[model samples]
Target: MADIFDKKPIAAFGEMAETGARPYYRTAAPDAIMAGCNDYLGLATDPRVVEAAAAALARHGTSCSGSRILNGTLPLHEELEAALADFLGCEAALVTTTGFQANLAVGALLGPGDASFSDMANHASLVDGVLLGQGSRHRYRHGDLDHLERLLAAADPDAGKLVITDGLFSMEGDLCPLPGLRELADRYGARLVVDGAHDIGLLGACGRGVAEHFGAMDAVDLFTGTFSKCFGSLGGLLAGPAGIVEYLRYTARPVLFSAAMSPASAAAALASLEIIRTEPARRERVFDHAERLHNGLRALGFSTGPSVTPVVPVHVGHAVPCLRMWQALHDAGVYTNAVVAPAVPRGRALIRVTPQATHTEEQITRILDAFAACGRRLGLVPERAEHDWTPVALARPKLTP
Candidate 1:
């Protein structure tokens, strides 16, 4: 038989060495600026965070060796969960092996005659959670409350309903309207769930997430987040009322079957969480970097959609031009993610740029200069005018894995 993986799109896959927020790809030199990593607060390589992880590794070795429901439960896990619940203002929280599983566990709450209303542009994990559940799924246009309301109005009056959205969209770099979602969920007698994977440690006064950013902390019924982003570690968490969390603790397959988060990851996440709480300046610096980059890209005439978070998307229309621009930037010592196809709509490709708190003003200037030169060379932005480039409408291309 022909190689099953031969047709896979391996062009996007590559090996690289990462140190904290900076990545050293084989195609780029050591000094390449990483604008693609999700280490929003730059705590991944912090001495304190690293020390915590090292200590845990020395104490607990490598793996937890079992699921959280079994012998895998550790004191560190409980401590991290408690800290997370307290930080997010939830009554209880459960830690999972991965952020994807945390969201997947949401499906445990769904049953026959239930419904989940999701944003069209929600993360794949959220989409998969609904798919794995027995409940009916309804996806509204991204951030469109009217479409959500319509779907809610059409659902069975007695069915359990969940309105799920990402606190901050990873690819688009836009925040979900939490206040509006909360209002609609209340009006429709539905529970609201916000996935804060991309927002938790990078948003709000206390870094609680978009719910806290919009002053809708109590408005949301459930909150999910990943440690891989802002926490500078690997794991996931789901926080909510004690009763519901307890139910999933014993019931959700993702939590019950998967191996528990390693002790090192748990410790690192705890350290990072503490840092996020105490260091308000880190959040400030990240927001500053985001603003500078966004404004800089926009001023160079790139179409950066409505994004006010650290995740910024530079729209570059089709895949070919997007890859060309990415290559040009890579050659110029600026690294960014080249997002294309199914990650977005068929034709809406973009260069995903995420600035870290550790980046200096001088580095930000260099990044902007690289983008200005590369964008003009690739014809992805204007040569002179500061006006946003009008995205071309292209035919939908056939998608592949």
Candidate 2:
């Protein structure tokens, strides 16, 4: 009872606000380098993306003011869906008001007679969606193909089956086993669904996403993605065969009940998608930057758990230390996300660092320098003999509030 009463609320680190689309952002410390945003290509601040939204707002006003089933369907909506279908190499696609809703719509298609095999590390939206379906939910260990295979083999042969996984695991910064999951789906007569929230505009040679990266584009039964991450907009998209997509348009409750996406959002996503396809250099830069950051962190004696993508998690092991590290880094003019219990398991707290294509080399260097200083001060890493430990931080974060 004493422990419970004395427990304090976890430190709130959600104070950073973007002044523009660049690497530096306005926070309590004035200006700090943004290394934690999900905007992989930095398209959120691109002039083209901004102009598209402005143009859309001028042309279509503000809100759709109704669900797509009623009067909400606009020309931009259809155009974006068509463009998404072409980009993703699907027969058809449907746009949702939110990525969370997209997953809910897909998973709600399953019921008592259906079964869903999910990865243990899949996004909460996918997990909750499957639960809402009221189906037999079989959770396999994270990225364990052998365990997934066994689960699939043991399920009822005649019951409808679905396999759900995130294209990229958000916490671990690892990708899903697409080829393995595809093979398992073929063997077990299950439809494979992917939540490509972090994959679209980043994965594959042509930026088609995980299926394209794995050469299983045609094998996937459903591909769901979000505009918030890659496109720097707001909304979700689900791409599949015409029959399935058409059925979802008619039957998905989220689509029927929810207000349609704002016109500016649809336009911005469409514009961003075009730029993502045309600008190959942006994608290449992001990959190279991710590699540099990953190697730099490991060399500084920080453990990045299985990260080969832009999303990098530096393992801190304990919740308190993790919070301290985040604060230290914040004071040194670098912003990062502090992951703790409820988001991850106890003793697995971490600092998540994500790099953007638009981040300059100088910004990256500054970030590394700050991390080195903070890590050494916190005893999180060894002190380098070559460098003096002068603090670069202007102010430390306020943890009480």
Candidate 3:
């Protein structure tokens, strides 16, 4: 019999890994600078967060060893869920072992004959979640509410409808129009679900997320988030109405069958959540770094699409050039993620960089300087623009559609 594994195509990073070309997987490099990681608040290394994990390891042992529905319901799990619910201003919350699993749980709630409207650029977890439900999926253009409204108008009004989108798009780094989505949901009698994986602890006046940033927190029906990014820990949360959460607690496959989240992860996430609530300076500093980095890149004439948050992308138009650009940046000691198809469309390859609150002025300057050098050498941007490049405004106001 033929081997099944031979049919699987090799991944893009396989070549790099085989050659030991930089050991990007390991973070032990003495001088490596990370501009590509998702640790937005810089709390992953906080002493308090570390201490909390240590305490949990000592107190609860390592693992819950079973699913949450059975022997796995620990006190720490309940405490973290309550904390997440309160932080997101929701009636209840469920903590899962991973953010991907959290999205799957929400997706699994959709039944046959139900309908789901997703953004073209939504995270893969959201896409996979919709597939799990085996419902009709209608994907609208990314961030275009007009397209979504048109699609919704043609769907059967009586069918159960779920509209799914990312609060802050991870790759393009733009905020979704939540108010418009809510208005559409109300008009069509659909439920609005937001995956705030990249938004929570990094947006709004108080970092409540995109819904709060847009003053539509009360309108969103389901809010899903991850602890891996801002919390600097390993877990996921689904916060929403009490009845719905209670329903998913027993129905979602991952929660019903998978092992419970590790004790250390729960404790660390709890500690990080508390810090996010109390320290407004971290959020402020993150935006400060983002503004400086965004402005500096735009000044150099690199196209950064409609980004208002810390996640920034350098739009290089093809795959090979993007990889080349990444290699150049890597060789220069700056670490960034080079994305290509199908993370993005063909010919729309780009480099993604994220800045954290812990990054200093000198660090930001070094990142910019390296980009300027590599960008000029690659001819990705003009050596000097005859006229200054105009900066695109953060986000346009959402009007009634």
Candidate 4:
């Protein structure tokens, strides 16, 4: 008999499990290592975060029991929303059950007259938001201001356009050219929305994000971020002008219908925010770990893409070879990610690596040693360094387009 599972190609991960070469989860013994999670701050294990969550769970019980639009509007939710507004310096904020929902709610609420211009590399949430908004949407090439400018020039000047982009692209770890993005939006009279899911607590003066990085905080129209990443929580938020927020609270089906995030997650996120302000070193440690890995990989003659942030991808451009390196790294107890075609173009195969603020020097060294050993084992690295080899990790920045 024909079977659905039999006809479907094996999942990339199922193939790995078949080989008995890689474990499906991060290590927990000795020193645990998680390669692909977005926990940039390492706050999931922090005592204060755990305590705050425990207190919230004790006070509020297990769940909110309803949507926030109705009976779910608990005091804890209000407190967290208020804290977020104050913390991010926005006029108002609406916390959603997940980061995906925050973007979805906002994108869905921006009525018929509005439109959105998105970056090509935007996260799935933002893309989903625009799709649900029921308005016109156009995506300019990743970070190409020229492409954005040209598109704006061609569109009606009076069109209500929202320029949306990820502050720090998740795959490349490079920041959007906010200076240029802001200028184009200004020239074309469009509002700007920055998806700072990968930016907060890792960029800018106090981690307010790209606006903080580019000194254009006041210029952005809306900012959205996730609690899952640096905050070590599971909710999402939209911080922006008061009226738009109040409008979404009443409308936006996702916000209106979705159940509230648990009190524990909300409280944990609130505590993480306090720590973000008090301990700036977490942000510094992000850079420290990034530099060590970036410098180490470059020293070994790997083709790491332009990675200004902690996320790094070394291009191998062939699927089989890329998988081989990923398998080797996983077997060596130094975990990593394998990115392939369609998610990227057909010719661009990558082994993506992320370093957290809490990663130790020993871990960093282990990671490099694994990559070096794997590269040699697979003949990806020459017997000796290429005569023309130069460290390309930070040698040049690619303009998004």
Candidate 5:
């Protein structure tokens, strides 16, 4: 009989040789540039955020010790929720121990006689949340509004409907077509829910996220986000109507069973939120870096598909070459993420790079130079004329929120 304790997958999963804060990592190649982090504003290591977290640690110790519904609710949690609701332009917000739980909490809203229409490329948490619910699930091709509309049109009109998508696709780095989604949701009498985990602190003029950027905040019924990204902390939040939030606060299993977010995380997120509100320049700087990096990579004959955000993916077309490219960059003092099979489609493997607002111009130039050299060495770079090198327009149009 075969052994039940098979561990091949675990063995294949390699560990990070070095880990540290954003933009740089101490490794064998010396000060390796960290291009895989999601800290868009670089506030994770900012003194103000650090100090706030430290103060909270001193005052409240560590864990909240119980679920929010039990003995764990804190004033900080309430304060954070209030601030998040106001910032995201929602009536109320509920904080969860992690972003994954926040999405799971949304599943609590689903039941029999309901349906969830999800984008195929949505984050795993969103996929899992749909699975957790009792609703019938329907998945459409990524960004395929026509397909989504077809699915919606075919569903029973009387059934409760939820249209779910990511505000910014983590791997593709493209913004969702919120305006179209809004129209579809309204036409179908469906509630629209956007998970803005990657774009909340970086996209809109007021940093509200893709919905705000596209003038569709009113179109969305609920918004979910995580502090682990631009907020420079840990925890997740779901914001929406006061009644819906209150409902999830009572019925969500993740909320009722999981421990409350630590005091330090709440304080750090609160401090980071204040910084995000006060400092618009950080948002501008990160976008500039993204454009610069995207343009530079394309100039070197590497394909960056449909990216307009900091999360740029360099398409390598296969898992083996993708891993080779990652190792080459890593050995040359540039660190990036190797996204392979299960995360993305097979033969669509790529290197994921994200730049921070705090990265210096020299650092950006160094990253470009490394890619240029590595691409040439790996024969990944073809003659400029041989490839379709048309640049993607990265400029954001001015808009008032």
Candidate 6:
């Protein structure tokens, strides 16, 4: 808990929680038509994933009770890592307690003396990782390869450089230009790191991720992802060449100090990976749902970003109206997230909604219907719920009290 003494506020600060207005929580379905959370492939509720976790609980009790590098290392952990490496087509893979640690480990240990380059809109975990690392870094414009090239060209040629970006922007649902970034990285003598946190089971031809989406297999140098989204698991992974992974497994602070993940989560990860590899139809369904929302919103005259993925954000210009729009949607029995100032810049608040593979066609249609109705009532859509201008966010969300 935070100290009450820290609650000192200036005249500009306003009451959000006290006003009894905020639209964000992780609860079970109130009814069946709910659509907000981003389990894009919707594997979290799969029978196979649930059963695997349950079986692990029965055999291993509840927790591992130690760190993996210490007494917490179990046979199940090794088995899961081996399976993940094969599935991701990486030489080796290291499983961490959560997605946050997975990225942190790499950033802290990988570039001790090298220079780093990151997209301005990369995940917070990735930013934190870079800050904790031994190298200096330059943040390029969001998904702008030209800006990245300019930064790369101006950097020291003798020093090592690594470029990083999110394969899919979580809030905007737009894809990064991987192929173009790869070309720039190679021409400038830099290694590329791609965060596939959202793209793993949602993008790519067979869900192999963005490397496959843009056919940049030869260009990517490092890769990281989470099991919670598509794997229906609750941990993170760092996959790459064998030697680098071994170094992280032994030296990363989060891995060395934190207790290991439970066997239940490990089992769930294994089951989820298997399902993702075997089921291509799940990804297809996710894309189909996204396309429907994109078309429907545009037809209603709502301004959306250039997104080609499952995440769709309906732009709302101010914070107060954004909150009202979120509340109206909730009253209509649909839930979504409200992003306001600082999370987004001033005058660019938005109501971000996501559609998943498990969401039926009727569910998608209902969400669009709610948007049209609530938007009209709120006047967010002057011509029918549409606004212009892109906000500088999609991920790296700050805590909202």
TM-score for predicted model 5 compared with the true structure = 0.93
| Alpha-carbon shift of residue 364 in model 5 (angstroms) | 0.4
What lDDT score is found at residue 393 in candidate 5?
75
Which candidate tops lDDT? 5
Worst 10 residues of 2 by lDDT: 392-401
lDDT of 1 by residue, 1-401 (tens): 79876875433332111111222244545789988989989999999999999999999999989998879999999999999999988999999999999999999888999999999999999988888788788999999999999999999989999999998899988889888898899998999989999989877777887877776779889999899999999999999999999999988889999999999999999999999888878988887788777777777888778776778899888766777777788889888887876788857888899899899999999999999998888777778864644432211111110
Tens digits of per-residue lDDT for model 6 on 96-115?
Answer: 89988888886655465688
Regions of candidate 1 where Cα sits further than 4 Å from its true position: 1-28, 386-401
Model 4 residue 295 lDDT? Answer: 71
**Candidate 3 lDDT, tens digit per residue, 317-358?**
877778778888888888988887789887888899999989
Q: Over the stretch 289-348, how does candidate 2's per-residue lDDT look in tens digits?
A: 777777787778887877668888999997777878887888788998878776888789
Q: Please write out the lDDT profile of model 5 over residues 20-72, one tens digit for every residue.
A: 11222335345888888899899999999999999999999899899999989
Per residue, candidate 4 scores C-alpha lDDT tens digits across 174-223 of: 88898888888889999889889988777776777767777777877888
- Work out the TM-score per prediction: 0.91, 0.89, 0.93, 0.90, 0.93, 0.90
After aligning candidate 2 to the native by TM-score, how far in Å is the CA of 193 from where it should be?
Answer: 0.3
Ranking by lDDT: 5, 3, 1, 2, 4, 6
- Could you give the C-alpha RMSD of every candidate to the true structure, in order shown? 7.2, 8.3, 3.5, 4.1, 3.6, 5.7
lDDT of each: 0.85, 0.84, 0.86, 0.80, 0.87, 0.77
Global lDDT of model 1: 0.85
- Assess the local accuracy of residue 79 in candidate 3 as a C-alpha lDDT between 0 and 100: 98
Which residue pairs in model 4 clash with each other? Answer: 143-400, 143-401, 144-400
Worst 10 residues of 4 by lDDT: 392-401
Error of 5 at 215 (Å): 1.5
Worst 10 residues of 1 by lDDT: 392-401
